[model samples]
Target: MKIRRLASQIVLPILMVASTPALLHAAPLEPTRGGEGGRIIRVTTLAKDGPGSLKAAVEAKGKRIIVFEVGGVIDLQRTILNIDEPFLTIAGQTAPSPGITIVRGGIDLKGHDVKISHIRVMTGVDGQAKLSGWEADAFSTVAAHNVIVEHCSFFWAIDENMSTSGPRFNGKTVKEWRAATSHDVLFRENLAAEGLADASHPKGEHSKGTLIHDNATGITLYRNVYAHNMERSPLVKGGAQVLMVNNMIFDPGHRAVHYNLMNLEWAGHDYVTGEITAVGNVMRAGNSTAPGLPFLTLGGDGDLAWYSKDNINVDRWGNPAPMFGRYGVTKAKLIEKDSPMASLGGLDVMPAKDLETSLLASVGARPWDRAPDDIRVLFFVAEGRGEIIDDEKVVGGYPHPSPTAAPFVDKDWNLKTMEPKSGVYPGQKGGAQEKLSARDEAMRENAK
Candidate 1:
């Protein structure tokens, strides 16, 4: 498929004089306060490849708000900036055009308390063998903590579009997500698309979207839209406390979600699966799509599954469609929680109606730029040919191949309840008379 990443280039002296003052100004130009409202560092150059340009601005001195004075494509030709600084922000919203687009390279975010907003990353748009590692994904962190990625776009990474993992990749160990162990990480109001087919990690034609690898913790995925890729619209692999809510997955080339418990991909040790709570999630087949792609994949022996509630198949306009016809989803029992979800653990589950409305309003970069409406990404929309995506060469194989011996149990059992709760129950009672109203309702309705 033809992929289009939004970006621009730099001019000479004229550009410098025109944009330098905007860069030096301290006014708040980003969507929200990042770097905890720290120093302002503006990116003045749009050079296709350079050292003291965009790359240097991000890795500048200390904690700061990094904004772009000019917006356009920066073809890095396979260079990756390892963002090891603490308390930093990459604000693409400050760009004048369609926002900053990076082609042929991606950054590895290793710092703490960082925010990446309003940018487009296309690591595979270039036909080169690719400069970075296989998993250099559009955005990745080995062990970054308190990181927030929102209102951004990623497509056609040689690896997954977005991911997090432990420090171990092979025999080599990285400090990204290793010693610190990621926690309180949030991904919201963003769009992830087309994980391109590549040979580096052969299992995935372009396998993953938002992939959370082993040993991460306290993740919150809220109101995002993931579309047209091989799989892993947020795959939960040996994660520790993940709360996924109000996200939509559209036209997946394979399964939409997988909770992988048994994996041998890492070099140091075996990967262990973690807990997940999925609420108000929508998985829908897109228009003019291919056939035979399933909606969910529970890896070999079906071991990992956690709390799930209120998932359905529908388009952006709320039109219903089969998530996948092969699986009889409505009656299947597919999810499991570490403990009963009744007590309502630490997850802050919002009312479905409110969450859906809010998400539809804010799923993309602009308040009105919802994914179904403004997302015109072409990689996933067009590129599905010549790649062999059978059982073996799937799961974006890297350190190890994902186990596909057992077929996924089509639907979630949610066996904790006699059945999954279907109606809207007020999440938190507000009025003083709510208890009295409950009693009165019980008395009125229980008599027969």
Candidate 2:
């Protein structure tokens, strides 16, 4: 009996020690799970094209996971990559130093099941004068589906910073093609700033933040911030199931939330119709916007379920605005949960101070990629520094002035000089290239 007891005790201790590591390792953090258990691809350069470049890394075909070895600016130099692969993950959080930044060029994701996090993409030009204001957005998708874009910052584009659309399919623009091309898109904890005004639009103040085109669905914009822009703080058209919860809009030039019913230019030809539900959002209007600038640009055909529960809106004086919208109901005390879209509602609406603080700390290219100057010139206007100037100082900027932040860019929407030390670091060639190894060993993961 003594020998048996001794053996049992010894075996039990050994088993406990052996199983502890396995158990601890099994519960990885949520950030590590973003790859969705796909083949990992490690990127080692900021090159625009070719091997070790972001373009090539994204262009490669597979259920791939991409991690950055170096954190620097990838100057596309007027080039834009059209991503056509499905089940891809661009894990910007893997960058040890600064994270990845894409400038001049943009990524047009036209695939499915893609996830991107903790990255920055910027188009330098202010407006569409260059490239006719088309194909030049920080991140755009045409017929892309199930995309999760989180913890990213987009700004300084001639058009909307981040947008989803239904491109021409089978040489025709139809509902079926539009539906298949884009759906189930999510944007969380992101920043969309400084949209350039379009030359031709009704308001003439035609900058866009999140422009959802016809034929999109399950488009969720959660806990996002839009700053220093004109119209289209998510201009939606074409029928889609949209949930915008816990978002913040600061110092916009015009009204937010313009819902188009494909009634205007596209009209009958290519109109987007969808359900829109906005709740627990914060809108702060500085001196830049009109005194009575509304929170929503009413007028759409899609089903809309509007709840104003637990929202914070302040005017230029930092006074809580009584009305949330110029068109819809002003103050909503309690969100009606009896609707069918209860899950889309915000669980807890964050206060303005908390939301602002959260954005200031969490937005952009994570903590590592931020330069000292990034805060001073990150969004449309430097947050505290770019307070609204006198409206009369700028034209068409009637009660408020236009945006005043962001580095000067060339006409082609490219920054004239990408200072390595300022924005994303520019790694010197032949330097000890940092290597972000592919974590998925089950699949053949190799870096070229």
Candidate 3:
């Protein structure tokens, strides 16, 4: 309760300035059904705030769905946009041509029942010196719940590309910790890549992918692409429950999937074990990957409840690698299980053998309208290229997506999934495919 109270105090001032979140008249539905049948809010500007901007729409509240009438980069001006309202849907699929890309800032979810899809976020260095402490996550949940994030692209973050965070020990009991922290979250079919290693983070060397922070519960990551991040693809801490299925990890530094519980953080509290269920996942070593790194590593001071099935680990040359390793200095315990305690009933859990082929074609935000950066990242994943960079400028920096705009016709889309009813996504023709072809042609010319 103290943690919750502290969070309220910090957020209340922001809410007071932005106006308190409006309560939606409709009852909240499941995470997948976020903002269904709510008012449609159109974002028509690239401004960080004010009318017709994303920050304004999110701060306005109610069960609302955001559709972009403009397509371009929204320079957040190095400010993290906080979503502290519930029952919201951010439908980036509605953007015209090359879709919405948020640059120089990050999204912080502090609300419940939110669904975000088809968006790209690039939180770069913003002219900060290396290790100068200007860290940011492309997207993160702060004690938020019932959230679903899919078909998004995250890059160049100084901190973890995407993560779930809350208090480590909210109360005296494990149940209280579970209740107070972020829960029932899902991230699928996204690309988390190129986290800036040794960038603006104060600690330095913080190029991470996804981190399910301590006490977060019921988190599921399915069919996502994790490429070029140094580590944490991803790390699950103590008192958390996570299910990772059919995800692809490429070029992780020393870790791929790991579990840890720091004793210093839980000094006064009793140790609450973490649970992980990994199925049909694939990890391929690349140029930046540490030699002889295992697919999954167990570390830290506490024990872990783990279940792994049919996962694949291999080097770039197709040589098989270690499946598991122990990296903790402490004599930590491992509780291996015959079956997964968490269920993946609704997930389309595919085989590890077919993961790379399946993900390469359709990963990241607006796969049909992919910017050049997304294309390059996917290409690098396929070719076993690219290294962990300390800065975003190493890979051409932030792209300049051509600005375009068009009316958003609600009848043309399936509101629930935010997919086009006609089965033709924007920029599907004469766009991303052409860029890919051009890139290939240039590569061939260079080979000569």
Candidate 4:
């Protein structure tokens, strides 16, 4: 079904504006099985358009299987596959071979108990790819009960160097195509890449009741790299109730984890009530040397504001010590023999102690360790004479603030400058003076 633009705009806003009322009145989605009780159809024959073949299979039997033996391209041009039946399994004999591409406008599974695996969805056409609706969305199982999308790669082409002036793209600014929502979905072992310069949508977008565990969700991501996805945002306002764990999220466009609660003004729907757990997940910010800001941003205008407690165990920097300098060190080397991050948090969790030690070691010994005998003695004396500034408290007050903390200190530990630092050791100069200024500014800003 084509989504009405007006409805789409109104729905998101209404969800934000009437959050309380909608939560009180919103009905839970009924559980369903997408043709779980039907016959199986092996898709041995390759079709230029896979969706048509899938539709044909569904027509033959209310429930069936579409298997791909010799992987080939299956294109779906803005067509919707509404598998309204129940108990269906579209299994692949094996993951799609390197050359195979399965393009779809979108796959909507409204039934119950459906499983689709071992497929690759490419949204861009070879020559006719457009800024909008190149592939649209590969899989969208709205209101479907128990849906699974595994071992699949959904890719779009994006060109970061282009400049277009229009709704979705304004010159150098990047944009994404608009599409329908996919709910109750499980995306595992998938790779999504944006190759085009003007593709209008982010890769890996999903709705409520979605689980993206153990998947590579970004560019240059390998099979085991579960990079942060720009597409996913929690539908519930106030907080996210999703469980995200043990995923290796690398170089996300935005913050590794985002709580999508801003649209509360539209539908007034608020399904989130508590913290969304991001345990044992590796998150990295993309390295883009552009005007855009890096690092994860929690909430902004048109976005829902959540209490700090609503975010559960999110290790902002997954790898305590990302590769230092030009060379990279193995995790085994940087961590101490019996570091807490190495074992205590289980194989999944990486603790703060481990994180700190790893980072310090990667950057070489502390100033004391590097100092000559005279300097070392002087350093100790300096430490004894200088006041110890509680960095944790200062940073905590302005969590994730730019310019960080290194620049605000001086030899005497007195407040100095307010302007952000620049140069080789940017935030390392003016010490106490800079820090106090920043602290006061932050406090005043908070008060305002």
Best by TM-score: 3
Ranking by lDDT: 3, 2, 1, 4
Better of 2 and 3 by lDDT: 3
Per-model TM-score versus the true fold: 0.64, 0.69, 0.90, 0.45
Ranking by TM-score: 3, 2, 1, 4
> In candidate 3, which residue pairs clash?
none
lDDT of 1 by residue, 1-448 (tens): 1111111111111111111111111121112234754666667666654553678777776767776656557777777868887777776654554345776678788777777766767666343343333545887866777777776776666677777765433233333333456665777667676666553454435557877866566677766767666677877665345777767676665567766544345435544445677787866565423454444555632234467677665543456654323222322224465453323333334555444333333344432211221333322322222221222124232111121111112132111111113311111111111112577888968985
Candidate 2: residue 199 Cα off by (Å)? 8.1
Clashes of each: 21, 10, 0, 69
Off by over 4 Å in 3: 1-30, 430-448
Could you tell which candidate, 1 or 4, scores higher by TM-score? 1
Model 2 lDDT tens row, 368-404: 3353223433333324334322121132211111211
Q: Candidate 4, 124: how far from true, in Å?
A: 1.6
Worst 10 residues of 2 by lDDT: 17-26
Best by lDDT: 3
C-alpha lDDT score of every prediction, in listed order: 0.53, 0.57, 0.82, 0.31
Q: Model 3, range 1-448, lDDT digits (tens) per residue?
A: 0101111112221111111111111122224567888999999998899999999999876899999999999999889999999989998888897899999999999999898888999999977997788899999999999998877999999898989998777776888888898998988778999999888899989999999999898898877899988889999998789988889999998789998988878788778888999999999999999999999888888888889999999988989999889886796788999999787665556678866776776667876566788878887887789988888888888878778889999898777656677767666543224344678899978999
RMSD of 4: 25.3
Candidate 4 weakest lDDT stretch, 10 residues: 18-27
